[model samples]
Target: MDELLRLDGNAAAGVLGEVFSFEATTAEYACGGCGRAGTLGGAVVYEVREMGVIVRCPGCDNALIRLAHNRNRHVVDLRGTTSFTTG
Candidate 1:
């Protein structure tokens, strides 16, 4: 779990790309059920062609519903960041 959280966006993208067999970008994900927000860190991959992207939420390991489809793009841009620790 720590390893999953530690993976950077690009690295996570690559892994998701391989899993889903489609190019993917790292996006910030929030749990629709719990409202927990963070970078995706699990292994499940979901591709929504209609949305033109895939979504995975680390909190619930589920797809995130777009709050603002046009305003904040789905991709969670954590370009030059590191780990997000929790207590």
Candidate 2:
């Protein structure tokens, strides 16, 4: 598909907040590749309808977070992140 659709990080904030029990957009995440820390709200988020969401670091463009769904469960991976702070 030549057309690429996307949405801002804030668009997923509500769904993420439901899973985290906090305002996910306000949570700070440190990128493992760049060591830059920023609120998740600032990350670039790409939504893949057939799979899930991919969150990338704003500084180095490294994939910081990924959310996917399997059979009957949802999975979240933060391997690209070194640390995370939730308030």
Best by TM-score: 2
Model-by-model lDDT, in order? 0.39, 0.82
Candidate 1 residue-wise lDDT, 1-87, digit = tens: 222232223444643443344444434444654566564444244443333333445555444422112433433332222332321
Model 1 vs. true fold: TM: 0.28
| Model 2 residue 21 lDDT score | 80
Clashes by residue pair, model 1: 27-76, 28-76
In terms of lDDT, the best-performing candidate is 2
Q: In model 2, which range of ten residues has the least summed lDDT?
A: 1-10
- Model 1 scores worst on lDDT over the 10 consecutive residues at 78-87
Off by over 4 Å in 1: 1-27, 40-44, 47-52, 65-87
Model 1 residue 30 distance off true place after TM-score fit, in angstroms = 2.9
Q: Give the C-alpha miss distance for residue 31 in model 1, angstroms.
A: 2.0
- lDDT, model 1, position 54: 37
